[model samples]
Target: MFLNHSREVLRLLTSLQADLLILEENELLFFNYFFSFLSSVLGLSITIWIWMLNKKQNRRKDRIYKQLSGTNALLIIWVILMIISRFGSILPIVLFGTPGYDNHLNLYEEYWILFVLIPIVVFMQSWFTVRLVYQAGRWIFSTFLLCMLTAFVLQLTTTVSQEKLNLAYHQRFERDYNYIDQEIRIAKEKYGIDYSEQTVEILKKQVTESSVKQVESVKKAFFGDRPVTLDTIILQKIIIRNYKEGGRYYYKRNAIENWRYALPIDILKQLSYFDQNAKETKELLEVLKEMIDLVNTPEIHWQEYQNFTETERRRSLGARYNIPDPLIEQLKKVQTRLLEDDLYSDFFKNLQAIKDRE
Candidate 1:
């Protein structure tokens, strides 16, 4: 009966480890279950193995005492190393609250360390076997339990660290978004940027529109159970950074300028069905893309890159965002014509000139 129980537990551990190895990618469901099972086995086996080894050592005066002393020394070193490595990982989660999915994988990848316990347990049982009074023939049983306990503690630590970090990251995003929205509202009020009643009504209608919902429903119909999160919105910031880094200031500035315009591109598309010019919308997007090549072709300036980085650093430090000097000069030229009642004809003419040259 005892042997059957041990065999069943060993079989279970083997199956879990196999699932872990085959998954190739980290899925939280499998990771949690595998670690839980491994931990329980280690805790049980360690206590039994230690008690049996201590009993055997009591009988033999010379050899058992020397061996036990050596084992104790090795165990102390093993535990100290484990603490140093693990505590270093958990400290950041505790301090900064930036626990991420990556951190979880990093903490638990040290799973192979449990195998070391196997050799230690076998050596203890062997010392007793040589003395010819080995009543407890459960070396395998003890080793498996010891492995489970070690795994349990490590898995627990990782789960706690990851949970802490995820909460922190989510809260940080919400806080920052709320603060930026408030700042925008304050700027709008200070500038006295009031709109007509009809314009305000259109804006309200856009807000109530379900364009995003319709697109998502279409996507879900084709792609089953795909998850989406704030990461999607965060990707736009990454795209903006990429454009700046590549010195595509014309594209980057125009994209940012869109945010300051009458309505967002998506909302404009929805509003287009009601008096919005299709040709103008197409021309705007076309101009945005063409400006990228024009800016890159006219020789990317080092000062523009320097100013872009400086602006980014200041914004991160909570400064008001501003267009860099090089882009500001282009805007000044465009605005000068607008003030002169040129009706942006010069802007289109210059863009045409660049296109003709290309």
Candidate 2:
């Protein structure tokens, strides 16, 4: 009998809790709809009030108010709309937390009635009101509207044409083939090494193959197509040239003066392309892999040390003060290896010699 009574009490409590939750949810939903409706109404009212005020001022016999043109009225309404749209949601979020799920619908659908439809209606109203109130000729008004539309179309066309021309220029003469051309030009001018058309064609083919391979590799790893960005394309080109001509070519021919100073992140990212089985490529890749690891490795492990005040640290030379960063230690060893290794040292010396002669 006592067990049956306890079970009944538990079921009642659960049912009451569920009812409370449902009530709270319904209240939240109601508030959301109410706020959205209120906001929409407020925006529409403000727009209509502005239109009315502009009309009243323009109708005044006083020269100051009479001088208010239709363009000036339109500009005023535009400024008001911009301000409201920009700042309307900020106050609500600060005071009432996040808006309802329907807030987007309110913004996109309900607010369109306020922002687009009302403004358009206001604009047409102002247009006809100005004409009627001022007793302006219909022919003059029609000509003014036609002229504005024509100027807007012309400006849009010019902007679009300029953008297309810039895109074409970048594609044809500045991106892929142009890098090879510049390399050829530099060799011809500096070393008197003239490449024939056949040589150029071969170089272009090699670059195309390298670029396609790199793009595919990236897509396979990331599960996406190559990102349409100039920096990504340029980095891939640099990697291709570095791989084909040997890593030393970048240090010798490219503006990068030191192998150590080259972007470790870029080298680490492209490390998979360098064959670790090959003797020539192994050392550079190994060094770059170490550098990337060191970059990500923390300088200090704070959790290893006991928590102590600044004053405590000043008095005691303990484990905290004695701890040496592993990254710094590893970096020193890598630097020594780079300086001593013939693969890097000899190439750098030759580059320095060439620069000295130049």
**Per-prediction TM-score:** 0.35, 0.26
* Model 1 regions lying over 4 Å from their true place: 1-136, 142-164, 175-323, 338-358
Model 2 lowest lDDT segment of ten: 349-358
Clashes of 2: 0
TM-score of 1: 0.35
Cα error of candidate 1 at position 82, Å:
2.5
Clashes of 1: 15
Clashing residue pairs in candidate 2 (N, C-alpha, C atoms within 3 angstroms)? none
Q: For model 2, what is the error of residue 319's alpha carbon versus the real structure, in angstroms, after optimal superposition?
A: 28
The per-residue C-alpha lDDT of model 1 at residue 151 equals 55
Runs off by more than 4 Å, candidate 2: 1-123, 130-328, 338-345, 348-358
lDDT string for model 1 (39-129, tens) is 4443443453354454444456545654554455345445644653454334433321221111233424565354445335434543443
- Tens-place lDDT digits, model 2, residues 21-133: 01134333333333333333333334433644554443345334333444445554566556654444342333212211112223433444454444344345445444534
Top TM-score: which candidate number? 1
